[model samples]
Target: MTTQIKMTEPQMLQQLLKQGFEHLNQGQIREAADCCQRAIHIKPDLVPAHFLVGLVALEGQDRKTAFQAFNSVTTLQKNHPAAWAQIAKLCMSDGQINLADNALKQALKYPNKDPMVHDLLGTVLSKMGEHKNARKCFQEAVTLQPNHPPYMLNYANNLIYQGELEESESVLEDIIRIQPNSPQAHWSFSGAQKATNTKHIETMQSLVSEKNIHPRSLPFYFYAMGKEYEDLQEWDKAFESFSKGAKARRETVEFDEAHEVATFKHIEDTFTKEWFEQDQKGHSSDAPIFVLGQPRTGTTLVERIITSHSQVHSAGELQQFGLAIRRLSNHQDPRRFSPQLFTEALKLDPQKIGGLYLQTTEKLSGGKPRFVDKLPQNYLMIPLILKALPNAKIVHLTRNPMDACFASYKQLFADAYLHSYDQAEMARHHARYRHLMDVWRERFPGQFFDISYEATTSDLEPNARALIDFLELPWEDTCLHFHEQKTAVSTASSIQVREPAHTRSIGRWKHYEQQLSTMMSTLHEQGVPIDN
Candidate 1:
């Protein structure tokens, strides 16, 4: 008879940790957590157990638990790359970008590197406006896994920001040759360069017509088709494709109009002259200049012009100010900004909020005297910004309502501006935004500067001069030649902003006026003037 030997406690702990990792790989979150807990029970300071626990929490979308568990792993083994990487991801999701940057740096220092970690670090670095470093990280990711579609796609996308459009298209074509089923690759390919013929357009069209296409990928395919058609001046075809794409996208998102309405209404009702005037002293740093408005409304154009000045740098679309508001208000809701969160924020001391915001953005400010925080949605947080950083210059961008709505409608956003997919929803949302702005102007007259997109494009030199004057900066001819700036623009307007300002997009919306009847009618119903 063969004797059965019982495993020792150390061996048993090893078995549990191994089992936890296997379960995690198999997508068994609860089983993985249980195994991790059992391992921790035997050895409380077990780094592997804590790391496994963090992984489980991440899979379950419990960022708080994941952060705590990862912190424990770091405490046990400070040089643990995986743990630090996980912590960086959690911090990024929390809008603690500087902390995320630090954690990512730590993760990158250790030899036990993950390709995904490299890709993530690249994204974080790109967001921080470190284009060259970000490109290296992305290229390294592809090196780690050659011809890997995801990694290759990231590298190709980054090339666009670097203004290497031909190279980007070449890489995208290689991806298509490798993986024919990639809707995202096709979409990126379409937007990489202006289409002069029906080369890739036919390929995308065929992909969409395939019966086996994924439901989730329909929007990407359709949007690609829409863009190419628009480039070819096929307005009817473009409208149809855009409409189908919008419909498909709208179905995938869970957008609630009530939440937005309530949030805007709260801002209008609560944040008034009296509210801000009471206990008004804030952080004294005039380092932050905000360029904000609705997305696709020339915020990037304005930002490029301002940042072209020697005294200023672009902190691309920072979440710091809004995050400061959320943190100071003890916000728990993941909706970013809600009526409840806004209500809670009313009790905050503006100085503390201002201090917190500056602390978070200090790294991104570089050595420049002023840095533009070009987050378009920060328009909603204007009152908080003024109350906290009174000296912060806020430039609001205005575009023709039809052009603005149409611009957003045709674009495929990764995650934001949820109301843009549907014509009626976008129109109504713009109306609400306009209403809030009017109240803000009434409460804080001449506190913020407004620049019209049409006027700026039509009279680039004079408008650029006025913009510079408003910021109290010395006149620089470089500001007028903003398109000549070598800094990478990582916004949707990356391509357009890199070229000389033009009025081509001004009357372009008129081509689709018949197709966008719902948008026009909705704007009329909401009382938004359509100047074009």
Candidate 2:
């Protein structure tokens, strides 16, 4: 028979926290959360326990648990800046920017001078399209901790987002000088500049091989290495680097292929053409001009061009639509909001839905006649959008199928978009996306203006003129000079759009044909309309 040993209260709490962290690191979210909750039971006022649980819940996409845990930490420790910062982070991730802003302000009032708080605040401000204020926050963070690479990197990113590419390049150079081993700095720098020579290729290759580098950092460095190789026209090497980067990212990020497939099927089944043909009335606000398509398409370029007009403002990918849908369904997590829930929302007053959309966007409009919503993923909500904003102008952008898929595969997304890591998954998703668009087109004839990326780039003047005509607005010279505008572009195409219109990305996927064979075959199998 074994004898039972009794442990002290403090010892038990410490052991619980340690076990929770071990589970969390191993990706056992449920076990980690249980351990953390047990630790919290042992000591109700334990800040670390609450915070750890919050992080675990966040990883598992349980927004309610994470929000409550973080909120509890703030309540338990009134002056806890870190807790407030975590709250702000969760809010931002949920697309609650105003709440995040308020939380960041509270975090700043605390005595702790962690540059991280200020850095995060800067990111929030950027998300709100407040670039000037964001620049100030970034500058303050860099001032408070000049040697911190993350703060400096954020400062550099803010600069780049606001079209200050040269200054951003300077800041990135300083970061590289200060911390030579920082893969993030190198990766961001590559995005900001095009290389003429392969001088840094050998150094990047060696750094990627170094076992001392952090696992999280390798993906960024690998992508940067791929960009360099692509610039040099070394196709095989570029494919190798990009493949490694995508694989590295897939290891840690959680994406559900099954959920994605189900979501698409739910959408198709629920929003039948007959459902749209039913009598429904929406708020008569034609103030929104939605520009949507798959990522890496010309959506950003189109939005910039349209918002360049005097009567239009750019809202820069607002989450208002997603948030509105969540509120309507009373859902905790937007991703988990089921098709049945959406069907239930369809029975609600369309005016209320449309009103919420306008109220959320109008504040950002500053009384402009039109505001452009450049959310690419908004394509998924096309049916709901048409029902809510019947008078809204929808501008749908398209690109060559292979180029679009390849472009998405090459970049490292900050949040979700799990299918981007695998070529066939990406292609299949694109097929579904295209099919949905086709359904929408049949449901609402003469409702959307289609703009092909290749066609627009091939004949900029005429195509832009036609788009302006579609909007019932006269063309302005400034529309052609959209890149010269001072407004911030928060998308991945920020750097590329700052340059003049070009055909460089037109057939980008052709260079990696061998590597993307799986994608090409999948697209063909799924009937994704590959003209090029």
**Which candidate achieves the best TM-score against the true structure?**
1
Error of 1 at 128 (Å): 2.5
Predicted candidate 1: what Cα RMSD to the true structure?
Answer: 2.6
Clashing pairs in 1: none
Write the residue-wise lDDT of candidate 1 on 12-48 in tens digits.
9999999999999999998999999998988999998
Assess candidate 2 and give its TM-score to the true structure.
0.86
lDDT of 2 by residue, 173-261 (tens): 88888888888889988888887787777878888788787788888988998998888889899899999999999887877777777
lDDT of each model, Cα atoms only?
A: 0.88, 0.84
Positional deviation of 322 in candidate 2, in angstroms?
A: 1.8
For residue 524, give model 1's deviation from the true position in Å: 0.7
lDDT of 2 at 243: 96
Query: Residue 142: error of model 2 in Å?
Result: 1.6
The C-alpha RMSD of each candidate to the native structure, in angstroms, is 2.6, 4.5
Distance from true location, Cα of 260 in model 2, Å = 2.8
Best by lDDT: 1
